[model samples]
Target: MAAANGRPVAKRRVRLLGGLAVAALIAGLGVFWAVTAPRAVSAERLAAIEAIEADPARGERVFWAGGCASCHAEKEASGDDRKRLSGGLRLTSDFGTFVVPNISPHPDAGIGQWTLDQFSNAMLAGIAPGGSHLYPSFPYASYVRMSDQDIADLFAHIKTLPASDATHPDHELKFPFSWRRLLGGWKFLFFDDAPRTELADGDAQLQRGQYLVEGPGHCGECHTPRNLLGGLKTDQWLAGAPNPEGEGRVPNITPGSPSLKSWSAADIAYYLESGFTPDFDSVGGSMVAVQKNMAELPSADREAIAAYLKTVPAR
Candidate 1:
């Protein structure tokens, strides 16, 4: 009888322990779901953006400043072909080879069905339609700094572009990196819309330059180094970084860097406009497309960009 009583006690203890273990697992999953959930812009803000009348003309300026064509256009696309946003460019990174998606106006393949509110949420919140998280490779991290009006205008301008049914392959990512839910943790740690560098005595031109660089131009995406998790190292803003695509490093543009220290603001402006450096070397590599887009901008915008670069903190 004593032996039988002890056996029952042991069985009850085992059952209690198993129940606790199951409870703990359920709680863990709940926490993970909460952390990884997509967060879109507040409905009130979305309403305000919807009310703003967008101008395609102003959006053209935002389009060039944002360098949308450089990544979205076909790899061999040139001249008027750049306007065809049938995304096929393959951007290789440490995480994976991200094939740019078709953002053209095609109702089926592109974002033609996306409303202005959806576009605003994607640009500012990194949330995609149907509540999926967009990978930061889209550079929504920097675009989050853009104004509502600019987002509105940009959507309008993009609509005017020719639509293409051209579809690209999905991103090829390694192991755990392929999981989109993990991106919420990454964004939680690194995504910030704050100004990268603060100007001491900011003027109108300096402010304009700052907006173009920090908001639309997204220069830091290339010039600034990133942490192991692919987060931008804000402490070393514009200090230069290893090129993610191929050989050599992206040049540092901060004042403390020896390469840019010698170039006057005027020289920088001229380089953007003419693609010729002070040494008469022409822009090459990925920057060639960037320079071409910069050349199309009004001279003042180029000057503003140059002026802003002169003020960023040295690495």
Candidate 2:
């Protein structure tokens, strides 16, 4: 009953408001569940890796291909000092600062206690040993494209690194971004294990380059511009992007850009090996770490990467 104007309240109005409230509650619960759920690798994929033995010798290639040393190794480390995996490198981004954790064999400070499946899950699915979501700063999005064997070999090689008992500092994030559960929703949208592009021409060398660049190398994560959600702009491919950590822009490596249009496949290979451009300029900036990793690869692999880069359509 309405007391103020001496009018009776409508029953239909009350029922309509009640129904709307119930609907809103249901919608909120659905969103909550979607963001909190844990997504992991398939059992079939796990069984595939489990079926074969890992080769640590070949695993060394996987390690360099993945560039584990660049992030996991000690900061300011040069020469043999790069071998120490006592993590302290700080990756500063707009959202927060992520401190790379020690991935060495130290039981308390690293992943020494982790099983191969746990490592595989972290690489492909971005899930941690405790079943929580890992930050995208780890670049698992591209790693999702890796084959089961490559993951196995990489894990084997990681085991061979010397142990470090370094302390791992937690990441500093702004409110809401600090929540790990929210990453499930982020993963649901951006995490696909499929290769970004398929080679219509079926060239073997180009295919190998595609595998290396799209999968473990994760070139697009740095070279391609990102959307507001931080997902790479696939249509643009390697057309260049701003450094999330600030400062200089990442160069466009796609074909026909003036900077690289004149360079032959041999020139690109030489740059990867020696860090020198055709103009005789040495590689600098964050690319320094990647060039070092590329130098570790065989001459054939460097040439293969160049061959693939030459064929990409200019933006």
How far does residue 210 in candidate 2 sit from its true spot (Å)?
A: 0.3
State the lDDT of candidate 2 residue by residue for 1-315, as single tens digits.
Answer: 356544335556677888999998998888888766878888888888877699988988888788777888876566666667788889988788999999898888988999888998999999999899999999999999888889998888888888999996799988788998888878877788776776779889998888888889888889888888777788888888888778888888888566888999899999999999999999988888788888898888888888888887676
Instruction: Go through the candidates in order and give the C-alpha RMSD of each one to the true structure.
Output: 2.4, 2.3
What would the TM-score be for candidate 1 when compared with the true structure?
0.93
Task: Report model 2's TM-score to 2 decimal places.
Answer: 0.93
Give the best candidate by lDDT. Answer: 1
Candidate 1, residues 88-174, lDDT tens digits: the string is 888899998998999999999999999998999899989889888999999998999998899999999999999999987799999
Number of clashes recorded per candidate:
0, 0
Alpha carbon lDDT of each predicted model: 0.90, 0.85
